[model samples]
Target: MKNRSLRIFLKIALSTMLLTCIRPAPAPLPVILNSPVGETITAADITFSWQAQQPAAGYIIQVASDSNFRKIVVEETVSTASANLHLKTDGRYWWRVRARNESNIWGFWSEAAFFILQRFRVVGALKTQGYPHDLAILGNRLFIADGQAGLAIYDISIPEQPRLQGKYLDSLNVAWGVKARDSLVFLAYGYKELVIINAVRPESLKITGVLEYPQPGYGYALALRDSWVYIAAGAQFIAVDISQPAYPNLRFQYYYPRNCRGIAIENAYACVACEQLGIAVWKLDTFPPRQTETFDTDGNARGVDCRDGFITVADGRNGVIFLQQDQAGHLTELAALELNGYASAVTIEDTLVFVACGSGGVAVVNCADRANPFLIATITSPYAYKVGAIPGTDYFFVLDRDLGIVTVKKEF
Candidate 1:
């Protein structure tokens, strides 16, 4: 009787072990949302959201350039069901997610969700608390007059990954524009003054000099040539000689009736974007501006750039006006490129004019046929203020008020 009872106990123990070992793990299937399988994301940045899974300790998401996910670009394990990703390429991307249980065993991946991202694909972006109005780059360093957040600097050695190197905060006034040369950074601090920052070392900035305006307005735009800094201070065009960077000396000021927002200097002449007055040409080589010419715009003249003997003006709703300035200090309208969006900032490359169109992103205008300039491509963005091209590359830098600095490849 004892032997039979022992055998029976052994049999029961084996049966219990078999049952436990054969038990299958419960895997949860998470449904996809937002990034529908067949949808396309035009922007470079994408947000992936999904339905929550039950009995999950964490989640695993993979984003690959290929549908098979053979080469993964984004593989993350998180406790949340959402992921925001920034990609460098403009093409089809496959994404999928899986859940993990307390035992550390991962469930099968959910159905792959494939999507497309094209057009003005953002490859690099720097998001900050400050409002980025305008940006200037010298070598690998990027300087900006970041509105209320003050003057900011970043390392653009890797344009796709702009790392913040330093920042100087000014609470009393707003930083409207910035220009950097050698080791000096000239910042436009409203009409209060022009603040000169010694940025030989981006981490440690020094206020080497300040040039206050005679009147109360503020400094808006600046252009530097040789050692002279031509700036737009409210309704006046002023020049400061920075031969001694530590002590900038005011040279002269030319009062104009319109508000000056942007300034561009080429050779001995400087073009000022006198709002409502359109483009104001000044002979900087002579004192008191010598001679001046103004072009008519349908609306506000917010920005200006001089390139290849052409003066491109971002004339708000008036579109973009191309003016040809002669040695006589006179400007004649060459062409006008208009878009549905408001032109806020303008830059030129070859025959292409890149205009920052507020919420409409960047509008590329073809001026090859100067007499009939027209928009060729549009890069969409939620908030865009300024668009500038990298000196040696085909990439464009966009300063977005809310999204910070965005780097886009000018493929179109």
Candidate 2:
């Protein structure tokens, strides 16, 4: 009787082990929402993300104009938990996701989430004397470089209604570019070189110091980093020391082949938009800044801005050109966005790019995907020459050659 019981128990144990080895795994859990749940999205690309479901081979996402998914706009299967898409029109959108098991069986769809897509709008505009070339925003104040009218200051504490606070007019030279920090304002004083103004009292602004570019060069655009100011001039890229505000000094100069229209400083390097020569990169940490690299664009490379290892150029007839910087600081062209007008200048606020399109007005571009930039909208202006942003906010001012300062606000 004992031998028979032992044999039966061994058989039962073997059968249990086989059953466990052949048993099927449990199905993946239902998809859960992660973002864009009843929120207002202002960008060109909308991202749909969800909690990952284990044992899922893929996922099917559906986007529609209604909660019922009757009028579907997007229905695709992706191998990941997130999907990024660009919608052509701005309106309300509802989306949901469902997982697909390894056996190709679809799971239950998650509860639908909704979002709104809206672009920016022009809130207000103010006219200025002479040509409005460049602008800068410091705190609640807006400084404009008005060609022959010199520098104009306005209070933008209230964006919709800008009030003029002060003005500085020089009969000898024109103000081409302007940048401000603290209680001082830096002006690219045309053929007169760099002029520093004491804006401690905005209502009665006065010149504090002036540094003339070594003969043959005229300041057009300027970029400020720390105590150094890099200026894109007529025939040379000039650098100035502003450590002592009242006594500005010219530091270094790099011979540029063509007219330098715009300059942007990023970390330890300075990139200049050299009219016909395209874009030139200079290393700023050296005794005398050295030109490290150069890239040619399809059209006139008028303006440039560098951030997060990427460079954006406003190519006159080509619209916008995007470039990627490698670890060694070498640049490679990624893509080009063709626009309707001549792109003279560009400014970046986070992932959005605002371009001053000569006759096409101001073109807003979404650069969330650096490799592929898309147009968000184009605000109509008689002649948009340059663009400037309010630091971290969506509030930006377009320097319209004919309209002066145009304030734009992004509604969330």
Candidate 3:
């Protein structure tokens, strides 16, 4: 009877011990931290707080350099609701909390939380559709010339988030280039000539003037300066006097050896990039205009821009050619960098040059030294046709034949 009673007592004791072991220990204190935060937190030193599973004797907080809290940087025992932490540098930090009993047994670590510190500037990108050819910014608005679909206006007051204001679809041919001054918006439509519209009210853009080209297959490019408007027609460059915005008159036409694809004017000289003749510098100061000098290239030059004392040209076959401009306004070939594919357009700002290639994507070149240009980075789209850069923005706008318009932020 005594043995039986002893065996029963042993079984009951074992069962009670087994049940006590199976019951989960009180959960450790939980620490919740905020997230989706900035890299650099400039607020007053952060205060970390936590809630215990129950009224405890005290709490232990361990801040570690790693997510696992293996390398503890700070271990503190506090009996308050908050702990003051002063972080000096920027990096990812891990933290956890623990509760202790009067018997000096420490509880398990709570869930880990992390935070990061950053210092670099953040850049963003935006995308659009329909051949976005040229971008013209006026005040807080950005105007895009959408080929075939007409003109599209976007409110770029907020550079990061551009909103479409309105779109006008009144033309058949594609709108190639757009230039805005005051309340006037000049759109270059292939074969349709120049369409002038009043853009004061972007929501209600109305055609105010239409200047027709004398011949077909003309009016591919347009540039405006003061009261003069320069148009690049096939094999010829036409100048129009826009002193009277409502009535535009053909000032004159300068015949070149090959088709004029692009034109840019500075001072008294007009630089024209010709497909067959290379680049022709005309003396615009002359009454009828005379070709003063010409710089020949290996391939057809499609785009041209002048900055400081150097002229940059984009050849369809030869990547980019740097030409030095003399005091006489003459161009001398300095250096040429060969690109992967057919180069169509080029824009130079600060220390970077953006090249738009047909199927080769966009090539970014570091042109700090005009004598020795170096290719820095190349970002390609499926079929990038053209590229444009805003003067003061690091944002690059690309026109893709298949993807319409894609905006990329320059990380470098």
1 or 2, which is superior by lDDT?
2
Off by over 4 Å in 1: 1-119
What would the per-residue lDDT of candidate 2 be over residues 226-307, giving only the tens digit for each residue? 8988899878888889999788888887776769999988888889999889999888888688788899898999999999
60-115 per-residue lDDT for model 1 (tens digits): 88999788899897788779878877765456778999888767778778889888
Q: Worst ten-residue run, lDDT, model 3?
A: 35-44
Candidate 2 lDDT at 222 equals 96
Give the RMSD in angstroms, all C-alphas superposed, for model 2.
Answer: 10.4
On the 0 to 100 scale, the lDDT of residue 256 in model 3 is 70
Worst 10 residues of 2 by lDDT: 21-30
Cα lDDT of all candidates, in order?
0.81, 0.87, 0.73
Estimate the TM-score of every prediction: 0.70, 0.73, 0.67
* Residue 397 lDDT, candidate 2, scale 0-100: 84
Ranking by lDDT: 2, 1, 3
All candidates: CA RMSD (Å): 16.1, 10.4, 13.6
Lowest lDDT 10-residue stretch of candidate 1 = 27-36
Question: Model 3 segments beyond 4 Å from truth?
Answer: 1-129
Best by lDDT: 2
**Candidate 3: tens digits of C-alpha lDDT, residues 61-176:** 77776887788767888876457775433346777777765555567776777765432123434555566666677767778877777788887656666788887776567787
Clashes of 3: 2
